[model samples]
Target chain A: MIDAHAMLGDETYLRLDADELLRRMDAAGVDLAVARPMGAGMVVDHRAGNDLVLKAGPRIRGLATVNPWWGPKALDELARCRDLGAVGLFLDPARQGFFPTEPVATPVLARAAEYGWPVMMKTGAYVYADILALAEVARDFPGTTFVAGFGGFADQWFELPMAMRNAPNLMLDASMMWGAGIQQIVDRHGAGRVLFGSAEPRNRYAVVLKAIERRGLDESSRRAVLHDNAARVFKLEGGRP
Target chain B: MRIIDFHAHLDERWLHKPIPDASHMVAAMDRLGVAQTCVYTMMGFYAETPRNNDLLLERSQRHPDRLIPFVTVDPKEGPAAVDELERCLERPEFRGIKFHPWLQAFAPSMLEETMVAILKVAARTDTPVLFHDGTPPYSTTFQIADLARWVPEAKVFLGHAGLADYVDPAARLLRDVPNLYGCYCGSRPGDLVHLIETAGADKITFGSDFDPGSWELLAERLDNTIEAGLSPEDLEAVLWRNAERTLRPSSR
Candidate 1:
């Protein structure tokens, strides 16, 4: 299984040992992690951490965070991220406290299209509704794939499954899947559509993996959500350690 | 490793009122292989006074091997707070105290005298005290740290201490405070790997803050933490070891 979303090294590190963070990912059986930049402050830090993860090598798939404020500079980093070994981009709908589909986001979307990279957004607990505007953006720019990183918080499956019901190019990551919305996601959408991801600090990945294992899904379906889908989307070739 | 879920809330809304019974909570623990949980009740937030410590005591009677109960009290009522502390100590079922100083509407700093006095007894009793700090009504980590300094003997656990700001502040306070440990329930994981690597896994505990995040949110937090990476031993500490040392012994 593949972790569709994750951070590079230790996020929120202050006097923290970066290697330890990598060690944690290794221990969790994550073949590759899509690490992102800190919310807003880490525009450059995102690049640096991406560089750090790249230096650490392939197991770390870097995801760059751009300051919507950075304008074109943010777009420049998109290629920088790809060069730095980052596989995609991580965006918080509320990161700069703006909508992802806002006109201001156009440049960033263009950059993703330029790199043909997947842009990730955090959506939890019916977050799908809030991301519909983002869906419009995804639809407009078919070249740029928008991954609803958290699948809009996996609430009642009412909004989460429905949001993704039609968007095949749009993938929803269940990285932060908890008891809150785990069952409904699997029940309504099946494990095939939801990629495996443990928000790392939210809960133990083993817990989520175990939940999926014990749940009604089969091994092949599990492998698709856990590994195949992420590998296919990110084009990661067996992300060997 | 004995589990200490330092940040979980067992509200009346959980399963039922007065005492919400989540037999499933124990079931979840059993499934995830958690040994014990240091739990508090939300009913304490609504009523005039704190909820009885026996809320956990009742659970321990059923699953002594897996559950540890903590006292959730209103520290705002001055001396009466001491009375509640006495009640908690009277029963061996409780080992620590859980307070939502934010929701409880009490200044832990202003209550230093009361805290020092109560923590004095807690020191003697060896009962650790866990307080809600981050979300804030009035209590802050700086303030909670101040209180911890005054009461050197009482082990102070900060429930969501640096989480409200959720950056280096929470990580720093968690490491700096000697008596204080943090409960990671509602806080974001963006910085959590840093907390575990820097703070020493023993200081942080896992909590789901379930009712607010969703009953199964802890499952995700566990997923994220594990994915963030740590050695088996360190991960075990965050999940159960450190908490076991602080909470389980006193309750017994």
Candidate 2:
């Protein structure tokens, strides 16, 4: 199994290093997980956090996060992280205090697109980061693959499946969403673009794993969601990282 | 172990899909080993108050042993809203009041006069009020805290416990305000643990927010609560004891 999203770093809120993450992954039967930096790395210094994530072993791959407010410097940081073996781009508009569709973030997004990387945008909270805004950003960047993290959970869940219906380039990582929502998206939209994301340390692996497990999907579809799609999106193919 | 879901939804149609009858809810409850659920209607919360409240009360009566009814009144309706709460509480089947300010489109601070009037009625009848919080502009934690502080006599529950964000403020309010209680619904597992550790488990209640026919979601939420690894005593309190106390008039 592959978890599309999980954090690594020791900070104020979330505390998880690569070894601890690998131990939890072993316990949960997860083969590979895409790692992002938490806390200060998420909000402040992108290079410092990206450096930490790039240091993970083969079982873990890194996703780079850059604060768009950093402007041209942010693009430089994204390029630097890409050189450091960061697989994809992760942006938290809510935490970073910028909207996904805002002009300030578009240059960085364009840079990621040029790198042929998928961008994971945190959704479900903060008006700037909800699925609707994600849909808008996806429309602007037709070439780039945009993954909606948490997939409009808690509040925007009611409109998520329909929003995904309209945005074809948009994919989703099921982190904090409910089972029925995931089931509906897969049953209607197909599971080709859907990936299983545990959002671990912030959430429990078992609980999120249970959501996909109980979605009543057949084995192939389940594998597509849990491992195949994420591997394809993060480009974690050809043996180890 | 007994589980009493403090938050769940009963609606004619959820996201334009028809929800099955109360039997569907009971069946899900049976599958998840949940004993009872405090049922609220989304119809009343989104649109049409009185009729939906009546339907919620009636449907819950079908399986009174498993489902408890909580009615919603849009405080945007002003005096008529207060009248509806009074009208619903006249029937013993209705145990609490639910408000979805984000959906109903009214801020508690903005609707202070109307909200206090409704809360006064809840205070008199000793009924708990559950608000759909954690969203900004209308349903943030600070707004709920202010409302809770305004009507100290009335018991309030922060439904969703700050959801994806705002859990810190939710935990703070839960700790500081005497009547403010937290519901472990819609938040991540780590956030739930943080709330319990910071605010204490005595006042927190477990909720699924499972719309009718969502058996998988019901089961998933229960799994999250268990995986949170609360002590047996704390788990018991969160699972049922807190809800049982909130359901009874004198306990709060």
Candidate 3:
């Protein structure tokens, strides 16, 4: 199964290097983990962290984070990271301190669309990246797939079903969500729009995996969530790991 | 290892989500090696306390060995709350009480009089009270601690042990409040290990906070705690012994 949301390398909160990430993934029975740099890596030095993910090999899928405030430079890095075999782009409106729908972020989303890459946005608890903000951006970029991280959390959970129902381009990552919450999303938007993500090291991958497993989806929907949906969205090859 | 899940729920009405019934819960318990589970109906916290209590009682009676019923009482119901508590506690299957201040929309601290009233009944009947303790404002650790202080005669279990962010405060309260015990459900492995070390294994119990569909998540948390270096003796205490001692004092 592809973990659509994961992070590697040291951060302010937790330190999970690529090797340790792979080791933990093996322990948790996760085949491939899609990772990106978090916190300072996104706000301070994006390349150093993205480079670590890129160099870690195919078992780890890398998503480059670019500060949209960088304007043209951010757009250039978006293409450069994709050229370096990055699966998609990662944006953090909260950590980077920009509204997702701002003109500055527009260029980044436009560039990602141009690269044919899906954009995964951090969307829990942050005012700039809340469910409404994410919905607006997803509506703005029809061609780009926007994965909502943390399934919008409990505080914003009530708003998620409506946001998800309204935006076809928006998908939800099942990290840190309760079993009932995951089932609600699947029932509202179908299993194709839900992807399994483990905000690992901070949250247990096994917990999220179990949340997905408990949803009692049909075999086809379960496969779609655990692997097929991510593979189709991120264009992941080599089937299930 | 033999397991007794301290926290489990019957209804999904709180989230307006559907969950499996008591039969599915027993099936999960059998597969996961959980010998028994203490269950409360989610519908109780919403409203209709007596009805939900009866539902839980009936469900537990059906699977006496696999399920232990915990009645939910809204102290705000005043004298009616006392009646409900007395009625439910009369049953041999009803072992404890469950309170969700946050979901029930009452300030846990402001309900001290009501809490003490409920605790008075609990102490008299030898039933433990498990309060949903986490975050702040309504269900904060300090708020639950205050209730425990008011009714020192009653056995109090802090649900979720203040979750991840409030573990330190929960541990601090656990240190001073002799009657206040900790239930490790939906807590971080590191936090659980630290709590075990700080509060002593006798004061900590295992709780799954088992949502019908998430048994694997509950098992994973248990696995994490085992990996965090809980000793065999300590594991047995947290897994079942402590719960039995607190909820079923005569069982020993």
Candidate 4:
């Protein structure tokens, strides 16, 4: 299964020497990993880690880390990532220190939509408000697909139903929080809108995988979530785990 | 093998909403082949009523053998927190106390003075303290680590030890600390196996933050762990024994 969300960009978040992390990914039963670095310098030192994942020979695909905080760097990384066979882009506002819809980010977001690249925004514990903001952005740009990582934190309990009702293109990944949140998201949004994501190495992927398996979802939906949805969203060719 | 899930959640999403009841939880457990579970109250900090606590206590009491309740309270509520702990401890259903410093917006270090007082009560009453750990840069691991050091006698459980790859720091905490027992509940199947191999499987607990993902992720983790060739005994220790050792007041 493809992990739709991963920070391959930032050196700080993931410094796993490429071969080692890839080995771990295999052990985790992850077939193809779609990842970007956490922040900007990951782009600078990109070759060091990128060389490792790139040589993964289809077992891994790299997402170029764009510094949304920097217009030039952000746009530059977009084209670079597209060329690198990256299927998606990972963005974190808390790390970027600016909201996704901020005027400065408009150029980057617009560029991503132009290239038909889906933007995965890291929602830092904001409940529904952050997801709602992403949905608004998606609505503004019809072609853009906004993947909200950590979608349903405690704060968003009331707003998720409404958020789902409003934003059809907004996708949620089940990576960070487990337990009731998974079922709630699946129930409200359906399996298609939900994709599987395990914040690797940081969070144990096995436990999250088991939670999904044991939650009693039907196999078709399970297969879709475990890899299919992410594959579709990211346009990845990785086989199932 | 009686698998014990050290991590699970009961939140507002499940409280007034269409949630898995004791039957639903048990059915899910049976599906997962889990024998017992230590369920934490994530929503309790936000809950305004004593009724929420009552509902949780009642729910746990209903399935005492299978589900062990970990009472959650907001220390910000001051005396009310103490009262709630007293109330929960009086009941046999709750195994011990559960604290979420990040959710409560209180640093674990700041709560120590009060936690020390509570730890004394916990030691007297023979209950342990359960703390959530997201590690560095998400939340301060040291906050919980500090609390753990201060109350050496009180067995402390730290959720998310293999925290997404905060493992270096989390691992250091696991190796360095004597009283702290960490539960691996983050993503990535290999991480758990790696930690299981690297840490000798003695310091970790298996936690599936299930019900969040339709159950596939958690099940995959457990299945992968078994596939990695852990002895049934080590598997039991990770999936049940360690948690049983940490959460059981009488075991201390």
Candidate 5:
């Protein structure tokens, strides 16, 4: 299985390198994992983290973060990330402290859309990262595939369901979400819009994998969630069961 | 290895809708090889104490070998709460108490008179008290630690190991508070290994916090923990031994 969301490099709170990430993926039976620089890593030096992920080899897919505050420099970094084998883009509105619809973020997103790269945004938390704001961005960038992390969390319980129903361009990762919520999302949005994400080292891969398995999806739907959806959306190569 | 789940909930009143009943829970236990499960009712969160406790009692009685009931008390119900506790504790099947500070809208600090009264009874009864920890203000690690410190005699289990954010602080509290134990519910596999390393396996227990329809998730989480690099002895302690010792102190 491919884990749609994961992080690598040192953070203010934790340090997770490629070796540890690979170890966890192996333990969890994940064939490949997509990772991005964490909040602190992004703030300090996203390029360094992205470079490390690139060097971690093919089993690990890297998503580069471009700070919207960097303006033209942000697009430059996105290009660099693409050269470094990053499959997509990762944005954290809550950590980077910018709204998704801001002019600065719009250009970065638009650049991603121009490349047909999926943009994975941290959502479910309050303020700038809420699902409503994410929906707004998804609506504007219909061509771009937007993945919401944490599946909208506990606080946005009601809002996430509504957001999922309305926003077709928006997909959700099953990280830190309950089994029931994952089932509801599958029932409402179908398996194609749901991706398996572990948020590993922060959350357990088994927890999210189990949530998907517990949904009682038919074999095809299970494959769609476990790897196919993420492989298709992120355009990951060699991510087949 | 034998499995004893320290956290499982009953009642159809969950916000998620269509909660599982006792039969569903038993089927899950049978399938997963969960020899025993400590259960409480979700209804208790919304002040349905008597009705909820009655359902738990009936279910536990019906599936005496599989279901181990943990009587949930609102405490804010004052005398009624104490009476219910006395009533439940009188039964051999009721193993412990489950407190949801966030759900019940009470602080775990035990500053409230009713909380103190409940803790006192718990101490006298020598029953373990599982406090819902993780959320802030009302149910944070420090607040649960305050309750643990206040009632040193009562065996306190911090549910979720103070969640993802407060594992370090929870680890510190576990070292300082002799009565305080960490139960792995909704905790990451890495954190579970960290707790075992930092606080020792003796002070940690395993709990699925399993909702009615999420049995496969529970089994997978257990597998995750096993694969996360615990020794067989440590795995046994976490999966059942620690919980068995805590719930039945005589077993230790």
Candidate 6:
């Protein structure tokens, strides 16, 4: 299975490099994982972490993250990151402390859409990255594939399933969500737009994987969420790099 | 060892599908080997606090052995809230109190007078109070910590243990607040592990946030607890012993 989200960086908070993430993937039965940069890279320096992800080897693909506050610098990083083979763009409003709908993010979002990179936003920060606000941004950039990471976790799903209907470009990852919630979303929206992500180190892969397995989804929806959806969204070939 | 889930809910509005009674909750508990589950009314979170509390009372009365009811109050009701809590405590079936500051849309910071009265009532009765914590502007771990400090005699639980991002703050607060404890409910396994490591295993009780039409939710929470890699003694504390102590403080 392809883990739709994870972080790889040698930062003080969660120092997970390629070997550690790959080791975790092997243990969790994950074939490939989309590795995004975390820590200082998420908020301050984007190039160092993006470089780390680019060199994390085949099993770990890179997701480029930049602080939307970085403005033109963020666009340059996106261009450099795309050329460096980063598979997608990750925007963390919580860490960077910006409302996702801020005009500053528009240029970054537009740049990513221009490259056809799926944009995954770290949600769950109330008004800053509220899922509804992300939905509005998704509507603004209809061509960009937007994955709402954690799907507005910590009690934001109350209206998100319905919100997905209005914005076709908006998708979700099953990280930090209850099993029943993920099941309800898939049942309501179908598994084509939902991807499996463990958010490991912050969350456990094995525990979340077990939660998904025991939910009793049909094999088709299960495969779509666990592998196929991520492959399609992140543009992985054969569920791997 | 018996497992007692300290947090579950009984409100059809949030259940998605129809559930005629508490049998589904009991059946799910039985299948998972959970001995008892403390149930609160989720509908009370949105509206009809007393009516939903009565509904929970009736449901708990039906399966006295398997379901433990926690009463809810719109503390904004002031004296009426205290009276309702006192009335509910008249029956031993109601073991604790549940509050959802975020969902109930009443921050304890804003309703200080009502909160003080309710906390005093819980303290006098030796009843544990569980707060749906981990959200901001209302139910952050620090905000709950203030309540715990306000009524140091009362047993206050951070119901979700700071959920996704607040676990660290919850753990930090647990270190300073003697009356404050955590429920291993909504926070992920890694956060739970950190809570256990930083605050000690004795500070937390296992909670599934389980409700009807969500049996798999219980299983997933159980997986989270087990995945935290607690030793048998620590697991026992989180799964049941800590909850038992909190439920019946006399036993402690």
Q: Which ten residues in a row have the lowest lDDT in candidate 2 chain A?
A: A232-241
iRMS of candidate 1, Å = 6.6
Supply candidate 4's per-residue lDDT for B63: 69
For residues B125-176, could you state the per-residue lDDT of candidate 6 as single tens digits?
A: 8899999888887988889999888889999999999886787889888877
Residue-level lDDT tens digits of model 2 in A42-127: 88977788988887888788999999998888888888888888899999898899888788988989999999999998888867
**CA lDDT scores, all candidates in order:** 0.63, 0.86, 0.79, 0.66, 0.80, 0.85
Regions of model 6 farther than 4 Å from truth: A10-15, B12-17, B249-252
> Residue A120 error for model 5, in Å?
1.9
Error of 6 at B64 (Å): 1.5
**Pairs that collide, model 2:** none
Query: Candidate 4 lDDT, tens digit per residue, B1-252?
Result: 878887776543654555556666767777879887777765675665356667777776676777777777777666677777787678767777777676667775666567776776677676867677763432455667667788788777677764543455666776778877777775344455655655667888887765532355456546645644567877778887877776756322
CA RMSD of each candidate after superposition: 6.6, 2.3, 4.7, 5.4, 3.5, 2.2
Tens digit per residue, CA lDDT, model 1, A150-204 = 5554322335656665555566676644443556655666655667776654445
List clashing residue pairs in candidate 5. none
| Candidate whose DockQ is highest | 2
Better of 2 and 4 by DockQ: 2
The DockQ-derived docking category for candidate 6 is medium
In order, the first chain's TM-score in every candidate is 0.82, 0.95, 0.96, 0.86, 0.95, 0.95
Q: Estimate, for each residue in B1-252, the C-alpha lDDT of model 3 and write its tens digit.
A: 888889888774556668776787887777778898898888788888888888778867788877888888888877778888888777777888899888888885666677778999999888989988874458877888888888889999898886744677787788789999999876655566668777888888898877565566566656545655678999999998998888844331
Looking at model 1, residue B151 earns an lDDT score of 76
Mind listing the fnat for each candidate? 0.44, 0.85, 0.07, 0.29, 0.37, 0.73
Candidate 5's DockQ is 0.37
Candidate 2 error regions (>4 Å)? A10-12, A238-241, B250-252
DockQ of 3: 0.15
